[model samples]
Target chain A: MRAGLDIDMPPSNDPFYAGLGQAVRIGTELLAALIVGGGLGWAADTYLFASGPWGMVVGLIVGVTAGIRNVMRAAQNWSK
Target chain B: MEESPLHPFELHNYIPINLFGLDISINKAVIMMWVVVGLAAFLLVKAGRSRRMVPTKLQSLGELLVEFIRDIILDTMGKGGLKFFPFIATLFVFILFSNLLGLIPGTYTVTSQIIVTAVFALTVYAISIVMGFILHGVKFLGILVPPGTPGWLLPLMIPIELVSQLARPISLAVRLFANMTAGHTILGVLFGLAIGGGLLIGWLPFAFTIAMNGLEVGIAFIQAYIFTVLTCVYIGDAFHLHGADDHAH
Candidate 1:
């Protein structure tokens, strides 16, 4: 049973684990934002704007903005 | 016969049941989930019932798990986070157990399924959003607009913030799903090689399988820990929004 009792400390405090966590978080944040932004843009184009690909194009741009901002904020918090 | 690495993940109904036009079939992954839950519940209950001043091994082990979870809550969300110990602890234990159980040959890996992890992640994400609004009121929207941004940038920043916010649960879901799937798939391939190869050459892949199994065990625990900690961090962000007031000079 002792061998089964491998309770571990929280990895949040360990620099290496923290770094890995941050990387995962940042990657997800950026990709998710882009996907969401582009999705919204595409939706607008299809439903409201009725433009060919402009809506998706605008959405991609918005996604880029969100992704960059997310990365910056994450980096700032990490530095702190 | 060529064995596909993904064959292990294929679902087959053990006991098919339909009620109200819903296919609620008993499958390997579902059975594994119930087994993990039952085992965890039984252990915790037994340990609790037999508590003594001089601790038994089971009692001590239970205490250690509780303490570890408590520290995680405190570290991420502080004293305020203690309210969430039950939730965080359950998430940690369930995922940990599920991962470990999957390490056993012939058992299904539940977390390897994107749907399961997605549900967990999305629930946490939804609850965090609701909690944020409840705790901070309309001011929670202020999380989108960083402090000290010029008026012109507000238009640009808000949409970006919204997109990033939406990304949280997705990342959470994909991380667990990808990790579990990749690890198990590799193990499957290695085992296939070991079995298919003749006894003489089989020893080589067999040796690698042993090492990979050890790594998967460690990964199972690590992934569970990561999921729980990230959930805590999201909850903490909701409660505090630490940088919401930081002004750029």
Candidate 2:
């Protein structure tokens, strides 16, 4: 057990854990982007436009696009 | 009488206080935070007192922690990110101690509270935004619009970038809160089983409870490291948004 607790052991360097972290980061980023965009759109619809779901519909589309873009960017960054 | 797995998380006011229409009671969670702060301060002060020619054990331990935090910041943000060392170090140590301390029986876990982690996350998020504006002025908005983006695509790209940026704190807070809550809840359930079962069957769950405790200790450390590293990454993004374009291949 003492040998297993070697200070020199590079624990975080494991690719598996790194990949898992990246996956979680990417998943959450995508979800958050959609929520924020749609949320802003909903707020605008409610307060400014009174245009029913039009604002939210646009917001969701914009959000999805943004989410995809974020995922792509994250993937690129991670690969580097 | 059966106890709920979440009974440990219930807030019981040690000294109930109401002032200015606010329930500012001293609860277990609040007391635990104070205890963690005191312990960290005491340990750090003692470690700093011994400036020996050859490092003492306490000093070495302190230096090791400092070096670990420094390495995380440097790795994620590079040399320019060193300026955030103090803030990041404090955040790391506080959360680490809080998580570890919660593992002891009859102690509350501060990080398990969504509000606590959310506040920490939001504060980091605000600092990153403020620092970006201070360092880059109007140019900081460039973070919302990646370089080499087509002129027509700006409408779509901007919102995506904005949402992605906003997600950082939410993820940061939720990750810590969920991890701590889940771990503790599992441990609680297992212990309840061990006690509820007769002596013949109880030992099985008791053994599992011990094993789970060990895993929780590792998770406590990991969550702290993750929280600090993400903060560094966010700060790094703000300071070096332009550099990101250069590195994008």
Candidate 3:
């Protein structure tokens, strides 16, 4: 009875095998994101502790770099 | 008459109700859940009532929601996933509306409560398990055992995969709850400070509130998207789209 309401059905024999390779790729993408995000966060917290104009400059650079890294990772992995 | 800025969750405003001799305090979270359900039903009915080539604003709004959800489900989970549209659509609408509703002054955020969010997470977890088992029969657990893993490593890998699989619901629920609660509390504290402090401090807090509120709106859309996408991902696992073969990746 509940089957009646299902509108989305998986394609028959639609290469379920293909996903294994994709999973490996996704795992790499995830690791890359974590490593990049963590590395940036740490760098910002460490060397950017100065409160003067120079500190602001370094912090901004680190933030932008980290943010870009995250975006790149996401953009790369968003497709099937 | 002045209204209380404090939401129902504040302990000072708490009320208790007795049902059949069982004392259950009717918390703000419960009230908000009721409101979410009511608003969802109202929007759906209003949106469903009129069928037209040229739709009115309200009907068009509903149609837009339907189309939006349909596309998301179709795109991410494949056409086969459409069968679960009602479930997914309901989940999205309920979560999206509930999160937005909490933004209104004087309303409690049910999603902010861990219990409430956990229930949703558990529901997703249960469905994933049930669907996996039904689709794969005894092979449902086969999902945790990735194909091509060395036999000796199977013990370690399976446990890790199983743990990660279990973590899905907790992560799903906590992410939404934490984001919503943190944002709401920050907004609350800021606005409260705005009221308590003079214009100088108030101005900064007020600006922050507005910016955060805008961010929250973006978050409302994103959480819905994330929840739906993850749903597709889990369901995809059930179908073994990623290859559940014993020697698979």
Candidate 4:
């Protein structure tokens, strides 16, 4: 009694919306990774180690790398 | 009177209740959630009540939404994903309704609250993590290691992956909250300009306000769609660790 069993392409079909969604997603994906990494590093610096800027520096490096990986992974999902 | 664009987001409690030192006050956002849940329930029940061969408009719309969600789950998580249909469907419907309902002027967008979105993100992430551990036991840790990584890079890759994993819920929560908050803030600014500019020069900003509102509606649908899709993808990853990796690659 139901229709629309085959509606498989709503997300990929509409370029305007799909692009907007993907763009928004990727932007935050990158930022969130950085934030998490840096936050972790900053916490370690403040709480655990009296390490003068090294913990944060290392954390930011991991954050940037993770951010790139996230962007790449998200990009791989595109229809192109 | 010129009001800040963010003035709309302020919460003035209707009824403040403190239990065990927890403030669970009733606010616009709380009322909006009740309204959204009630409306969604009423529509869905009415739509599904008459399961006739010739489906009515509401029934068709409901079917379309269900199938759309089913397709997302199937595409990401495969046949096994059907078991999650109830959770996934509820999440999709609740978010879609909340986003659309919030677009109405004078109504609070419940999702605009970081705490609300964070709860959803945390719940989804926790489910995936718990399910992963249950299915794979110790091997769930393997998810942190991407396939085909050289042994030498294991130490470096593990930390990076850990950070990325932690970022998933953060991104999920921030994306929805930021989008809703940003969209509403733009609308508020445009509306402020429209009012303050008066009849002489207000029409331009007013027209832009209408246009922005239309765009915001589209954004509402897109944000909801993205959230559901990512939820599926994350859960699917838990279902089969390397499955999504292969598909995406």
TM per candidate: 0.87, 0.86, 0.70, 0.95
- Higher-TM-score candidate of 2 and 3: 2
Model 1, residue B228: distance off in Å is 1.0
Predicted candidate 4 versus true structure: per-residue lDDT over B1-85, tens digit per residue: 6568889889989999998999999999899999999999999999999798878778888877787788788888889989999
Scoring model 3 with DockQ, what do you get?
Answer: 0.03
Off by over 4 Å in 2: A1-27, A45-80, B244-249
Please, what are the lDDT tens digits per residue for candidate 3 over residues B95-149?
8888888888777677777777788878877887898889878877777666688
Q: Fraction of native Cα contacts kept in each candidate? A: 0.47, 0.39, 0.00, 0.69
Q: lDDT tens string, model 1, B40-82?
A: 8999998888778877888988887887788778777779988
Steric collisions counted per model: 0, 1, 10, 0
Per-model root-mean-square deviation over C-alphas: 3.9, 3.6, 12.5, 2.2
Candidate 1 lDDT at B166 equals 80
Native-vs-model 4 lDDT?
A: 0.88
- Candidate 1 regions exceeding 4 Å error are A1-29, A68-80, B244-249
Which consecutive 10 residues in model 2 chain B have the weakest lDDT in total?
A: B240-249
Model 1 TM-score, all chains together: 0.87
